[model samples]
Target: MTVLVSGGSKCGKSRYAEDIISKSGIDKKYYIATMQPFGEEAHLAIERHRKMREGKGFLTLEQYTDIEKAEISLQSAVLIECMGNLCANEMFSDSAVEDPVSKIVSGIKKLSERAGLLVIVTNEVFSDGIEYESGTMEYIKAMGEINSRISAFADVVTECVYGIPVAVKGDV
Candidate 1:
């Protein structure tokens, strides 16, 4: 099953997605940590997540980009902690900025095929009425496009509102 869970920051989307994978009864559980811990805040968040999964029997794979390239067994259940960071890494590279919609979408599709159960967590960053700068707007638009494409192919699409999982496309 392919599940996509999306919501605002700190809304329990990551925990919810983890639960989905943990309860699936799959022996090989993998947590694909997509965030590149570049600074103090990112480091702290990563540590917190590590503590959360300390005893969950999950093998953490830190793949900042090209998720399709991550090696995994066919019987494994994978939880991708988020798309926002992944997208940013793909978009604003070290030398240049590029559109990441197709690359991210394609990579995720390939990952879904390889894993027994795939749960993807994404952020809800579009609801705010304020307009952003050109670069930020590009990111928002790219995220929307990528999410739409993934949600179309996902078996379950859930939105976490105030830590409550609400089904957007399929049962949570």
Candidate 2:
């Protein structure tokens, strides 16, 4: 089963995913965190997230750039926090760096197949409004494409508004 939770920053998408994982009845749980600590701000943010996961007793594996590696290695239920960062890493990486949406879809499919239940967290960037700059517009377009693809694959698609989840797909 695949669950996709999307919302703006600090809207509780990560907490939603974590709650689902904790209640899924899966014995082994692994958190595949994609965000890399870039500086003090990022480091502190990551540490805070780490503490939250630790409170739930989740085993976390920091998979910075490669989702495929983590998917192949996991035998338990996996929660991949924030697809946006993963997409950013792929876009900036030196690899082939072709179409990002296709890469993300393929990665999600692969990971979904390997885990008992795969819960993906991503930001709802499309609802943020139109962008004036060319680069920002392109990024938003890419994120929109990725969001659509992931929603299609997701067994449960949830959108968080003011820390409340409104089910866009599947049961609430």
Q: Pick the candidate with the highest lDDT.
A: 1
Which tens-of-lDDT digit does each residue in 1-172 have in candidate 2? 9898989989888888899988987878888888888989888978888877876767788876767777434556789987888888877667737787787788788988888889989887776566568756766778888888888878899998888999999964
**Model 1 local distance difference test score:** 0.90
Worst 10 residues of 2 by lDDT: 66-75
Candidate lDDT values, in order:
0.90, 0.82
94-114: candidate 1 lDDT, tens digit per residue: 834354788789889998998
List the candidate 2 regions with Cα displacement exceeding 4 Å. 71-75, 130-132
Candidate 2, 153: how far from true, in Å?
A: 2.0
The residue pairs in collision within model 2 are none
TM-score of each: 0.96, 0.91
- By summed lDDT, the worst window of 10 consecutive residues in model 1 runs over 91-100
